[model samples]
Target: MAAVRAGWRRGRIELRQSFTNRPELFSHFLWPVLMLVALFFLRHRDFGSTGLLLGTFALPGILGMNAAMGMVSMSQQLTADREDGTLLRAKATPNGMLGYLVGKVVSVAGGLLADLAILLIPALLIVDNLALGSFGGWFTLLWVLALGMVATLPIGAVLGSVFTTARSQGLLQLPVLGLIAISGVFYPITALPDWLEWIGQVFPIYWMGLGMRSALLPDSTVVVEIGDSWRHLETVGVLGVWAVAGLLVAPVVLRRMARRESGSKVAERRERALRRVA
Candidate 1:
């Protein structure tokens, strides 16, 4: 209980710092601004014969994509912390690693919400046909967001533990982008080939996007989904599986990574970085 409270407080402090820090603050705005620009251009375009504006079709999917990207953020931060000896420091102190992990979850989740709002608010104005005014809409949104985080964030921690360097983390982006392309974020998954659709469905991204669309899009939008149904049961089943698996595996991976950390390793990593710079 004490550790959890300390972790929560640490996370809040870090989150506050991120907003105050100039470079981090700029990063927070950059992607949302770019997305808004894309949505602005797409606002008037119709999606096939459905008569729904392309922007409206894409908005909720973008939100899901953003939510899923929390994994990437978690991975990157973990790798950076390892490089800089933050993880080492945590490992040295009693219950410190637990606190660190808690802080990270709080900060990352909070940041994701802020980023979503940054895009969603402007998006609401740009796009029409959303059903967010309903209590059911808000309720679905909450659960999907919560479940999506649980499904993705631990997998991210595992990935971060696997890749020990900032440079190595760069390699993660290509596969992620590929996943996004197939995940139906910017377009309907039904429009893709059967194999591609199956592949997309295997990952959390597709379900996240589907969940968001289910929450926000009108009932008529079901035509573009598989079987012309929301498949809420399937969404819950898949994301729940992921959430359980990630929770089980993440601690093992993180503990292993933590075990390998030492002052010597941190010094060696810094030296390698300095040499690369030189």
Candidate 2:
């Protein structure tokens, strides 16, 4: 209970700092603004013969993609903290690692929600044909967002434990970008080849996008989806599996990584960083 309270407080402090810090504040708005520009141009473009506007179709998917990218943020932050000896310091304290992780999740998830709002509010003005007027729409949005975060964040922590350095963390981006391409964030999954569609469906990214679409898009838009239905049960099942698996695996990986941390390793990392700067 004490650890939980401390973690919650630490997370709130960090989240507040992120909004107030100049560079972080700039970063928060930059991507959302760029996405809005893209939506502005695509807002009127027709999506093949489906009679749906490309912008409308892509908006919610973009939201899901942003939510999933919290994983990358988590990994990068963890690696950076490890390099700077934050994890080592935390390891020395009672239940400190627990607090640290809770702080990271809270800050990352809170930041993600803020970014989503920055995009969604302006997006509602720019895009048309969304089903935002109903309570069910919002309810579905809430659950999908909640489930998507749970499904991705622990996996991020595991990746962070494995990477050990910020440079190595950079290697994660290529695969993530590839996943986004196939996950139907900007295009309909049903339009892809069977093999690619199958590959996409195997991951949480596709389901997150599908869940967002189900929540936001009109029922008539279902024509573009697999089986021409929302398949809500499958979304729940796949994301649930991911959430459970990640929760089970992350602690073991993190504990192993923590055990290897020492003062000498942190100093060595700093020296390497200094040499790179020189």
Report the lDDT tens digits of candidate 2 across residue range 1-278.
77778889988999999999999999999999999999999999998887889899889878988988999999999999999999998889898888888788888989999999999999999999999889999999889998999899988998898787799977898898899889987778887899999999998999999999999999998887899999999999999999999978876777778899999999999999999999
Q: Which segments of candidate 1 are over 4 A away from where they belong?
A: none
Q: Model 2: how far is 167 from its true place, Å? A: 1.8
Global lDDT of model 2: 0.90
Model 2 ranges with Cα > 4 A deviation: none
Q: Give the lDDT of residue 104 in candidate 2.
A: 84
Error of 1 at 9 (Å): 1.3
Q: For this target, which candidate reaches the highest TM-score against the unseen true structure?
A: 2
Candidate 2's TM-score reads: 0.97
- How far out, in Å, is residue 122 in model 2? 1.1
State the local distance difference test value for candidate 1: 0.90
Q: What's the lDDT for residue 130 in model 2? A: 93
| Cα lDDT tens digits for candidate 1, 140-255 | 98899999999998888888998979999888878887898899977889889999999999999999989899998999988888999989899999999999999888877777
